[model samples]
Target: MDPIKKIAYNCRQATYLIEKQQISSITLKEKIELKIHLMGCSICKLFQQQSMLINKMASKHFADQHKHISLDTQFKEDLQQKINDRLHKN
Candidate 1:
């Protein structure tokens, strides 16, 4: 495979790992490749910035709300069942 394409792919994987909080699982070489790609790819850089912003906002919102929220066992079970049904349907 072409080196540039490989680097782009690694950048994408790095972005996903970052989102999943799994960046520590990536190899040093992959981290370097992603940094190099982000340096030159404006679109990917924007994506990374937006993703980080979203995660920060979501974490803050959840932290504020979780203290006041309580879900019953039945509700949790029903929600999980619905999610599983939808996934299986798809």
Candidate 2:
């Protein structure tokens, strides 16, 4: 494939990997290609930054919300039992 097309493909794959938190899953050559593409593509770079920021903010928000919430063990066990009973009945 041509260099431009290859870079574009790499950028797309990089974004997918980033969103899935699987950057480490990509091969070394893919990482190198993605880095090179990011260097030349301002739009992709901005996208990467924005995606990371969104993920960070979401994680922090969820963490804070979870801290203030508690679940009763009995309630959980009862709910699971009820679900199992309904499934078996059907």
Candidate 3:
């Protein structure tokens, strides 16, 4: 099998586990394999780490938002505009 395909498969699975929080937290063979791949691939490592960080931060942010004002639509719009601008630049 191609290395790119292998990495893509692992990335999809790793993201699911990261976002959904695997059913078995104690069993992390797949997670370990992902880390092993990350150790060698800087790009994959950055993507994995960034995704995990985003997931964690979003979870906590939503959990905390229950205390006060919620839904920052302007922030999201600004973010989208910035992203679009950057994408168009390329």
Q: Top lDDT: which candidate number?
A: 2
Global local distance difference test of model 3 = 0.67
What value of lDDT does candidate 2 attain over all alpha carbons?
0.76
Error of 3 at 10 (Å): 4.6
lDDT of 2 by residue, 1-90 (tens): 998677765767767755655334776776777777777778778888898788789889987877967789999999999999999999
Q: What overall lDDT goes with each candidate model? A: 0.75, 0.76, 0.67
Worst 10 residues of 2 by lDDT: 16-25
Candidate 1, residue 89: Cα displacement in angstroms equals 46
Alpha-carbon RMSD to native, per candidate: 11.6, 6.9, 15.7
Q: What's the TM-score of each model vs. the native?
A: 0.54, 0.55, 0.40
Best prediction by TM-score: 2
Error of 3 at 25 (Å): 3.1
TM-score: the better of candidates 1 and 2: 2
Q: On a 0 to 100 scale, what is the lDDT of residue 72 in model 2?
A: 95
In terms of TM-score, which candidate is stronger, 2 or 3? Answer: 2
